[model samples]
Target: MVFYCQRHCYETKYTTKVVSCKPAKIDVVVDGKKKKTACYEVTFEDTILFPEGGGQPDDRGTAGGVEVVRVVRRGGEAVHYLAGGLEEGATVTQEVDWTRRHDHMQQHSAQHLVTAVADNLYGFATTSWYLGEAVCHIELHTGQVTEEEMAKIEDTANQKIRESTPVTIAEYQASDPRLIEIRTRGLPEDVVGAVRVVSIEGVDANMCCGTHVDSMADLQAVKLLHTEKGKAGKTLLFFVAGSRLLSYLGECVSRERGLNTLLHSCPADHTRLVEKNQKELKGAQKSLREALKDLAVCEAKTFLGVEPRPPAFFHHRHDGDNDYLSAIINEINDESVLKVLTAGEDKGPGILVVHGPPALVAQIGPRVCEILEGRGGGKTRFSGKVTRLGKRKEAEKYVLGALNGSVKET
Candidate 1:
């Protein structure tokens, strides 16, 4: 059966009688968390909200003043999932989200145009297509699409839009011989009744069920953003049309303006300036690493100069990374003294490393990790992540006690 949505694509509101209302639960994400929400699966005698099918998402709208979260076709019926239940046989006003509907119409119509143009120009048949939230793409049965070809396809698509080609839809029976002429991936296994064919005036015709604009002019323009390699030697052509294209252009302009302000350069010079800054950053990082290594050596020497060397040594640095801790451990190179080194913020997450006699390192490593709320294991050298760097003093005390106890046993 042809749905009310398919018949009247431009209608935003309609009054229909409720056929059925059944309690149902659906998963919905609220504030970043997914949870089951109670709703009613209500079927109307007729609906302006399109059910999801043919690679197009369902229309969002309101039924009986309640939000319709989702809609799907079950057999020959359009089921509207409403946030609230409506009385059976009651007449209710359904309002479609016009902005969303128009966006989908523009995109869906643009896909038909792009697919036709590609096939006609380069003999690339559409294998599949995706209608994403921000952008849409069609997978062409080809290995690649060159830059020159892409430009030609995009130019031709916009030219068609300028000409305002008419888009027409017609229905035919399953036994009709005309079905062989229409382009189609295949009809659904459960498809019943007539086949819907959407045709572009003198351009192309295909079997489709998605709502679309009446004319190519409604698309305003089409932009072939880029191409990516797909499975089985297919090429994915990404594009945006109408409002989505305008939104993408707006984002590009905003980013360009921000870059100009930060780099104090024009759009043409921004790339060069960014590259120079990255090179300088790499140099600065190299110098810092060398300086940190030298400082580690000096710290090790200072500890070695002590008249009476301590049994246990603890060191903490607020800024260095795990590499810096490893540098300090390598310079000391003492197997007798228990060395505990940490690097990061005082009370935040950090790295922990312990080096000493094999027996002591194994025994104290895990204990120290527990004290600092970290995890690591080793025989003579242990390294792991720690979350409680502020407990460094307590961990040091535990290590010292273990050493003193060992000495007493000896």
Candidate 2:
């Protein structure tokens, strides 16, 4: 079988025949280790699967019932990767993912129209473009574009789509005079031979190797969603075209409905309602925190006034902080007193030990860590968190023992 070097084959169809297939090894890194796996890298005489290049992803599909996991162009040849090896010179049918292909076509076509409009309107050349699954973006040569300017550009691009302008694909030799007449962002130095040009009827003539739709109408719409600054003062305009625009609109509507339900307010007044609710929540939280601080102080005073004083007491605070714990310790006012406080719900118990004698706390803090089977460090006034919730009692016992001189060091 003879293999023809028809690089533009993917521009027309979605299926073609394979010309050569061979066993190959691909290194895949799993858990930080590279493993070489047996696979087949098939080359087609005329391929409909576009390789990953030109800021567009490769086409996903299958060949001969085996999944084409990846497609790469190596020196003018499109190599299709498959886990299941195919026979060399076998005639296998390649099926491309239609949804993804169509989506790419819309996005790539939208990019060209948008780029052309921006250039024609403001002389802002497109520096780069990306066709993402959810959104597409093109970086312009300007620092930033105003909201009004972006709206104008978007309107112009969509107008072209609404006009149903024909998107023509043509190939030209490197030395062709017509090539110089076309608008291009300049081809890479390595690009040689026939250059494929995608032109949008009187709008744009760009030297692009990426696949595009047959007409601007197929794009359906081009909505410029947002713009931000990129590297070297470039302004990046994010947009959605075709079905993706519909998907984005659906999501926005769903979110608005949810917000209305939760806030019991209309979409127009959502911001005002949310801010009011937040203020109320903040005030309530402040009051609750003050009550907690008062309760902690009262509890500390009660512990201090006990008829028969113990060496230390373990207290569980629903929610405690450094200030709350310190206030409690201050009210007790006993040099020999030791207070071990814990505050947690589902999280593993955390320890905050405060003692009257700084030296004693410095010594006993590390021992508490050992007893709890956790890790911590402290200085003069020792305070550290405990991780093991189950061992909370054991940790307290060890700390109390050390304070009362009941536990001896080994």
Q: Which ten residues in a row have the lowest lDDT in candidate 2?
A: 1-10
Q: Pairs clashing in candidate 2?
A: none
Q: Please provide TM-scores, in order, for all candidate models, with all chains considered together.
A: 0.95, 0.84
Best model number under TM-score: 1
RMSD, one per candidate, in order: 1.7, 3.9
Each prediction's whole-model lDDT (CA): 0.92, 0.77
lDDT of 2: 0.77
Give each model's clash number. Answer: 0, 0
Kindly report which residue stretches of model 1 are placed more than 4 angstroms away from their true locations once superposed. 31-33
